[model samples]
Target: MERVYIGMGSNLAAPAEQLREALKALGQLPHTRLSGVSSFYVSDSLLPGQPRYTNAVAALDTALEPLALLDALQAIENGQGRERLERWGPRTLDLDILLFGDRLIDEPRLKVPHYHMQARAFVLYPLAELAPGITLADGRALDGLLAACPFEGLERL
Candidate 1:
């Protein structure tokens, strides 16, 4: 089974509860086991006038392939009332494939080592909780990323 890390966020409908539910659902996926989860952190939303977001990272050991896992994640998001209304808009739940077994994947539907993770404290800091002193599939060091992305405006809860 490949180790996978998932980035999760929510700003609508009891964000923390939504993540808890998502964690339970993740554990239920076929050929998968929820191995670790990070502390929930609150950060302001990307756009103004939006509610602050609750974010965390999850580690999973799964035999399912990347796309299959992505599909399951999206289903979980949809079940939690996620909407694709606008870029960086508020949502009920959002899950992204952060890494998949040190494999660099570039697909139309997904990208491993997430294109923007290096710059987002919400993603990088929580991820550090689950996997410390790590390196991405693309050769980016986690510590280096943390150094570049300050943990400003992020409150661990």
Candidate 2:
């Protein structure tokens, strides 16, 4: 099974409950086992004037390929009322593949080691909690990335 990290966030419709439910769903993915989850955090929206988001990170051991895992995550988000009305817009749930077994992917539909993880504290902080020594394909340490992440305003819950 390949190790994978996912970032979860929600800003609409009982955000905390949404995260809890999402985590439950994640554990149910076929051929996958949810192995680690970080503490929930409350963070101001990346975009201004939106409700704060509850965020966390999850680690999984999965036999599914990256694209299949991405499809599963999207299905879970859609089931939870996620809508792509606007980029970075408010959502009921958002699930992003942060890393997939040290693989680097640059597909149009998906990117591993998620493009914005290094710059978003909401992603980095919880991810660090779950996998402190994780390294990028290029060999950058996750803890070091968290230290350099500029975005702040996270409060552990």
Considering every candidate listed, which one attains the maximal lDDT?
A: 1
Question: Which digits, one per residue and each the tens of the lDDT, describe model 1 over residues 79-139?
Answer: 9998898878889999999999989998999888898899899999999999999999898
Error of 2 at 69 (Å): 0.7
Worst 10 residues of 1 by lDDT: 81-90
- TM-score for each model: 0.98, 0.96
RMSD of each: 0.7, 1.1
- For model 1, the superposed segments whose C-alpha errors exceed 4 Å read none
On a 0 to 1 TM-score scale, where does candidate 2 land against the true structure? 0.96
Error of 1 at 11 (Å): 0.3
In terms of lDDT, the poorest run of 10 residues in model 2 is 143-152
Candidate 1: lDDT over CA atoms? 0.95
Clashing pairs in 2: none
Candidate 2 lDDT for residue 2:
91
State residue 81's C-alpha deviation in candidate 2, in Å: 0.8
